[model samples]
Target: MDIRIKEAVDLFQEVMFYGTERVIKSIDDPLWKEFSPEQIQMLKLVSREKRITSSRLAALQAVHKSAISSRIKKLLQKDVIRFVQTEQQDRREKLVELTDRGKEVLVQSDKVLTDYIENLLAQHVNDEEIDQFLTIFRKLKDIIKADGVS
Candidate 1:
């Protein structure tokens, strides 16, 4: 019985992984070509503030400066992110910000992603299942956090 439960759990997790891809694909054609996940996240972050620092981004995403630098370069090349050198004492600090197009993409892509998730929930999940899943995941999250996860 224990083996059967574990097998079922693994199988269900695999199916849900593929299911997320399929659901995201339903919105991919018209929007994904214009925005990647990192782009969307950066846009959303910068949209919340006029300017943010690279260190702040690295801290939030829990990545090294080099990785964030590479991503920021790509965003800069795509015209989705901008940087300004402020006149403050710390001239080396680049004030990274999102462009108008970046914010627009974030807002629009967020709408499409929300609609896709909503449709998927209606088709594949009931309210009780969602509530249960969230409860379980959050509980696990709390446990991991309590363990002092770095």
Candidate 2:
């Protein structure tokens, strides 16, 4: 591999670390006490899928079914999500759906996060730079998708 490629990878890793930490801190400051990151992700997934089984959510997330148990439990306890009866009528087959409160949380959190990032970018960068950053980010996303790098 080229030395410059290696240097670029290292720089990217450092930038990602710091960037992720800052974003997580900013988002978690107000919400972390109530919900863990896993719970939030689960809520988002359920909100998107409308109705999903625990095993299916684990599969979609590429995690073990047991790994999702605690997060699902917490969401249920918080009334963010609830189990719904499926047409199959199998009581043991865990099907879950988001509650109205969960939907509101998902929408509000998205708005808050978008506004926070947009404000931060606007404060430090012009529109052209923002567009350039988005272009590069989209290219990286495409590469990741092509490589199946979930």
Q: Name the top lDDT candidate.
A: 2
Candidate 2 local lDDT, residue 128: 93
Shift of residue 107 alpha carbon in model 2, Å: 2.2
Total clashes for model 1: 0
Model 1, range 1-150, lDDT digits (tens) per residue?
A: 699889978988987778656766667655677666665676777777678898878887678988888888888998878998977998988889888877777778878888878886899899999999899879988998899852
Best by TM-score: 2
Sliding window of 10 residues with minimal summed lDDT for model 2:
28-37
Screening candidate 1 with a backbone cut-off below 3 angstroms (N, C-alpha, C), the clashing residue pairs are none
Clash counts per candidate, in order, are 0, 0
True-structure lDDT of candidate 1: 0.79
As a whole number from 0 to 100, the lDDT of residue 80 in candidate 2 is 85
Q: Write the per-residue lDDT of candidate 2 for residues 31-144, one digit (tens) a residue.
A: 655776667778888977889999888987779988888788878888889988887857678689999999887887777678888888888999899889889889999999
What are the Cα lDDT values of the candidates? 0.79, 0.82
Cα RMSDs of all predictions?
Answer: 5.0, 3.7
